[model samples]
Target chain A: MVIPITTGKGRSSRMHEFWEALTDPHVDFLRIALLMGLLASLAFGMTGSLVVVKRISYVAGAISHAVLGGIGAALYLQTVHGLEWMHPLLGALLAALLAAVIIAWIRNNGFQREDSVIGAVWAGGMATGLVFISKTPGFVDPMSYLFGNILILSRTDLYLVSILDLLLLGILFVQYNRLQALCFDEEQARLRGIRVGWYYTLLLCLIACTVVLLVSVVGIVLVVALLTIPAAMAGQHVRSLGAMMALSSLLTLFFVSLGIVIGFLGDWPAGPAIILVAGVAYLLQSLLKRVAA
Target chain B: MSEPAVIDCTEITVRYGPVTVLDKVSFVVPERRTLCIVGPNGGGKSTLLKVLLGLVRPQSGTVRVLGREPRQARMRVGYMPQYVQIDPLFPIDVEGIVRMGRLKGRGLGFYTREDRMATRQALEEVGLWEQRREAYINLSGGMKQRVLIARALVNNPELLLLDEPTAMVDAHIEARLLEKLKELHNRMTILLVSHDATFVSGLVDEVLCVNRTAEIHPVERVRDKSVTRLYGEPVQHVVHGHTHHHGEGEEQPDA
Candidate 1:
């Protein structure tokens, strides 16, 4: 595997004509972005498996949309409060988790009519964030939020993402059995004294954390697809409810990485192209599962 | 053995939208006792059991099991769902399904040896210990019912709620299942829901009749008129040694 590095490698590799040949900033940015697209898909796929096992596609989508508000919160904090302590992903995650808690509370409290409220929040969040973005001075470009500046993945970004991913995987593994039970039957889960509300909240937090990296890498536009398709496809193929997750994470990495390479060669937009790759994989897996059965 | 009320339901009422399935019903299922919910089709038998297990909440009622709410009491409770409508090809093995009963804790972890032992004991109790390795789909109807019971029993529940446990079984196997239930009732509290009023009446200490309303009847006098009063049924049940038979004009009984 080619290990990712920064700084001295570029400077030292300048002597080699082939490595030095691509001097265009646009091409270099795009090249890095292709890799970022793959990483985004991996994050999305892992989170998707979480969504699938929890049967929370609607919740995930609602949470993803809620991230828009999180982004706005981060912006507001940084600008108004002059707090450099905020990161975009962290802010978004906090907001999304809050939304999850609210949704679960509403559902448990018999406020069945409030599901539509999530949709309203979705629109309102994006609109609020967009308006904030427009009013910000010297912001230059907001393309990073809509599409992505994946080409700008510094070494620090990769390291941060790697740590986050490990933490996510660790949390999932530690509570593996509980996740399986929660996936199968919530009633049974609660009977086992699994605080259904709290676990649900934790799941939302994990999903939000996962989505933060996904949004950062691939932008919000393509993140939802990456979060849903692979896990869904994996669920249909795997025998046990738990195995579906392992398969999903693997499938997610494969398609997204593959898509990035394809987009790289084709001079295409990496985020959307990578997500399409996952879609195609899902279609193929469906066909295969059908044939096997 | 200490005799506690494994399932205690009082003034429980269940409604499905506009249709009220069970009206204010009360019962105390003492440990080592068998209580059956017997009535015609569309009677509130299943709903009553569900309420007792906290699977379905009653609109206005008080329910308790082992001195706790049904939902909280569920850990010590085992359930055998009806086999009539389920597809055979549910993609689980007989023993695997049984294992689910024991490993149902909130935490994430591998099942322990104790869980495996429970599965073995439950299978043996149901007489399918020999066929423990069989695919659930490959089993006959009676065998499937036994397997379902085994699944519930594996949890070593203090209370067992059997919803139409023998509905799809053959007559001979139904009798055999009855024997197994009799043996199980010597240890845990058992509640079975079925339209086979006379049959269940012979097996249990008491019969709880449920239609739109619930009426408790002792085993000695659960005749057709009592059945009709609770369920408005035209059918008649003749009690045999332990089996209940509907007359020729009676519609097909669903469990």
Candidate 2:
């Protein structure tokens, strides 16, 4: 019920209303959502390109969910123990980074059951979150964190996302070749005196940070789809990693805006709507490719 | 006068858990020499190559390339692994693949003007210069293998290591490719690991037979019996276009 639905409003009128609100300077909430959506899309494009090229979508998923444990712990500490210093976002960031580093370490060290370890971490994180949530004194609505409500996004959240997006761009810009080499042939990269372990851990940590930023808008469950689908679609049409990132960012922006409009008129959840739009696009693209072939 | 060794190893031992993949192996390759390493599948051929490239750390051996540690000389060495199938869906052109060879230092973005020139030169060497802009996924199998070689060559290293370069190439292409390799051999030191002796017959100056251990001898000293003994199985060697098969008990030429 966050976005009000009208009985007789047509799609074109709704779009006009949306356009007016977007251009209006006084409509700060809508503006905040727009900025957050654009910044989040940028992060999604950069990290999604790495995730798909390096074939680590599942690890990105585990990191996204593992951040929930941090959120739950922060809430429990602040509410039940009266810890004023601990914040949920901080907790989420720390947990996400730790989970990413641990999973990447396990993989690089040649663990016998790396996937099983990822699964364990994934489930363990969710379980820990559930436990903390149960122990907290107040009744907290889980729906907001599980399926995102962009209406709740604050100006501070927009600033935080912008900072994270800047960090991703800076690091990716500086280490583009090294990262590309790692994705193409890790063994060759290692032979070239590039520390495969160091860069791999860095890549995962970047994914972790991006996941934390994404969870604020899409929640834990749906961020992976948002991260991957646009990149995969762009991959089919582009010839380089850089092109994929650029094109996917535009595609992600389109999906996010479309989903926001749909959610507004239908009074539905925005995150899932955005994912559905992307998923349907992927399916259609695949079918069209098969037909053309 | 003796040329300094481009590669020198002393008592190198590599182990994976309880399995000793390479056992106290030692060898030397002088500068500008073409050395071919012939061994069985499990006889530590690729492992030896890894040791030379510093990809695998030996428990006890000291390795030096160009009078420096293998790790330090990595930038000066170029390598092509055995036919590793790149995902056909990978979205990179042939030039992009070869440009990876020029990735020597930490760079932030796209290739430079010099890097592009080197990539073009490498592609032309392999006779695939015109196809530089073609998607790597669209190339034929033989073309892909050649593309990998061009990638290894783009860096213009003083020493090149190739593992089974012609493993998947067609018979006719393999012969022409070996001829091309012989031309490249005059300019740089080359270390190659291959099981197809017929293809490498005249291209190699020396053959190092490895079977958990290693021994170096001139190419003329390698007979069908020596290969069979190294492999511990029957080996067929083509001499003067005739296949000569040898068994384990067959007499080996001078050791």
Candidate 3:
């Protein structure tokens, strides 16, 4: 369906046919993608922007980019070992958590200025993927790794995304106060017997696991941006962290839906288009802030 | 308030890189005693409070509050760090900020009935109950400081460490805050730090002066005219352990 130019434009595109059967207008593919993308962005943005806080933006980038290697490695293992138990999605998630633990261990131990180490890991992982894919028997496409194809919205991806979104929401609902205390002033939280370090480690692992799957939908390049920019705008616009999270989610959905439509109509890429949409919104917000100031 | 010492620091030494901020400082805060730590800039007064509250680590020291380490017993230590250092526009409301104090026992749950009671009690204690749900950004500097103090108090800690609580408030507000502290003095031990030497006396039972060499002053030293006039007489000092002081003191010691 997403094969070549005019293939999707043809009246018989898989998505078009699927949409034609729908009761609503033919804006089906673009609409769902938009809704999913925005929800995905909203969750990611609220989480990602906090990295800019806790002074962990670069650290988070390191983790985010490093997750690529984890996914690639997991995919390779499933192929080579033929692990019957290893589903692609679960394998990807497991690999990411393992990677997160390893990174956390190393950085906390001796790999000081983990940002540089993470950057190294990022480039190294991508390079490793390139090599592994080439050496493997199948002609795997790396474009999806660098830039995701949202059109390939598999049922598995959607289910996993739904679960991840729910997990995030649940955790937030239960631990919003504790997470806030930890994020803003860990000492204060710790002094109150919050186990500041453990909760944080858990948060990082959760974020890493979530990003592993999210990157599949939005890709690494756009994942953090979509997550952060909307939250950043929300941070500026809303006076409360809770409001910021909610607003970020709404804006993410709005921009993503718009981006998906533009991508569909123009036959462009989804990942980059979604990021650009958020980026544009951010720029506008900045302009508005400056003007008001 | 016959409870044992809430904060007991035994030879705590804090260092930032190669610089020693607090060197082998030790103190015992009995229940309901207000301990005031005072010193010039960079004298490690605030650092001591942070270390006491487990905000900063001491290179060498053992701190115990309620018979546990500060980190392990953090729920028992209410801290009001220097409000000047925090971003005032941080996305929170007066009520939301106060609600943050109950985070310890609530852990990851929704604000329970107990948490609401605690938050309301704390806000009421600080006299900000009426402005509970107001946006934090809209508050005056003095009101914001009170809210921070209230947040610390929400956890019902045995010891409260307030770093320069009266720094940003007006004279009248500072006096009002002092009254509030006096009321709270019955509930918990207090450790306060300030540069306003004038407010040192008549507030606290003991004085910790960190002037390069950190040491504790007997309660009577605060009332000493020479010592009071040195920093400035009628200076705000921690009573019992509460720090209560008058606002207008520009007099410097040996200046």
Candidate 4:
């Protein structure tokens, strides 16, 4: 699993090296990383559409920032207590689900002001993570998790991402109409006996899972950008939620793949490059729409 | 007018912490008739509607919608909240919006042929069948109101509840909506909530004046001074044959 870090290499040599790494059976991290990006795009597209339309990007952002706490705790436990099974990804999934449920509970129960609670969770999660990371024994580079390193992803990460993809597809297959109703008009949906609270909680849980997937691809700070930008851009053109999901999924795949390639060519960081490309394209789309109008 | 009660509320009382939003409110709407619930803002108009729809729980009173609990009868009840309550930028078309009404508490099943037929019929009833493919965001305010009405109609409920249907639309659109509701009155029980009671007085069979407490009066009796006492001001009544007036405090209550 040792990956040689080659920087300041010529553009042509880097391109040649990436291709060589992709084809070399013994060195397949590059290929796995590319496949991971493609797989993550499916989730980014579907859940991102719901997140954007439901106007819960702040909630999603809170859930994502909360993931760092889980990762840090898992790293601390594994390093100090020899808890070999407590993988950082497992810790992340648990933390994301916990954050989603807490936020949903607060909203459903009316216990506290929602935005303030979300703000607390958003900052509190990161602060907790920072403390845990500081306490860990090894020199853990938080930057890799704060801003992801797609090249370091493993076969296990690929399997986890695939499971998440299938899980999301299955949920959407069953709950698409209900989710649509929930998003468009919650009160009417409740009048129809749609269990608006439960569906809302379920939607947040899905967003939690999607945030975990994005964390592996783009990390925490950049997850919201990748999660929302494609769907927001797609919304400007599509007339239906389904079409928005489809178009956004394509856009996500395009940005992730192109960003990966460009990062390889220019010897740049992959996660931020992907976000930068998405940000630029979104700005361009908005500009073009204004001009057309 | 003894067609059986479609909605029966017995001493319904609702309180938000220390503030009692509704107190000892009780009324009934007969089947196949239109009833307008009129009141000032924050006077429990919307809360009463929520009680009927089983959204807000009462501390001590019982609510029976169509001879069953409000939640139990939800599938048989169609509700149209103010169109302003919906997100204007929601990315759904007319057909998609109407199809949402067919969701019967089951999250897994696909839309059936019966659902599609009902959607089409609802759209046609609202006179928006031709615009079913148009995005809801692109629709005008009047058309948005119609789309909401169509959504409420898609389920073919026995009881229909509309909240502030004429809030943002013009007089002409309100008249057209009135015509549509009058046509629907022959099939189902209708309860509409409005702060401006005069706009719907011509079409409703009764008017329920609410201000923390509740009282029901026949539509013809709404012009009586007691209705004015309920509002603490003079209330205008629109006669069927006269041109509608938009000016404030210029027209007299029709005798």
DockQ of each: 0.31, 0.47, 0.44, 0.70
Pick by TM-score: 2 or 4, better one: 4
Candidate scoring better on lDDT of 1 and 4: 4
lDDT, candidate 2, equals 0.83
Enumerate residue pairs that collide in model 4: none
lDDT of 1 by residue, B1-255 (tens): 856776667787888999989878777767687878877777777778778777788898899888999887887888878776444433345676677666554445567899889888988888888887676657788888887788778778888888887675666877788888878877888888876654554578888777777766777666545655666546654334433433333443222
Task: Give the runs in model 3 whose Cα sits over 4 Å from its true position.
Answer: A1-35, A38-42, A45-55, A78-91, A103-111, B1-23, B29-32, B40-42, B54-73, B85-89, B105-108, B167-176, B182-188, B211-213, B218-255
**A1-293: candidate 1 lDDT, tens digit per residue:** 11233324443353342234235554464445545545554556566776875667777777767777778778777776787788776777777777777776776666676668667656766776777666655563456666654545675667667777788778767775566556555655665666767667677777777766667655766677777787777765545544656667677667766665554444455566677787887788789878987
Ordering by TM-score = 4, 2, 3, 1
Clashes of 2: 0
- Candidate 1 chain A weakest lDDT stretch, 10 residues: A1-10
Q: For candidate 1, give the DockQ.
A: 0.31
Lowest lDDT sum, 10 consecutive residues, model 4 chain B, at B246-255
Q: What is the TM-score of chain B in candidate 1?
A: 0.87
Deviation (Å) of A181 in candidate 2:
1.1
RMSD to truth, every model: 6.5, 3.2, 5.8, 2.8
- Which residue pairs come into collision in candidate 2? none
How does model 3 score by TM-score?
0.81
Superior by TM-score: candidate 3 or candidate 4: 4
B79-154 per-residue lDDT for model 2 (tens digits):
9886564666667788888888887645454678998899999999999999988887688877888888898888
Docking class of 3: acceptable
Task: Encode model 2's per-residue lDDT on A161-192: one tens digit a residue.
Answer: 88998899999888888898898788877876
B2, model 2: CA deviation in Å?
3.5
Better of 1 and 2 by lDDT: 2
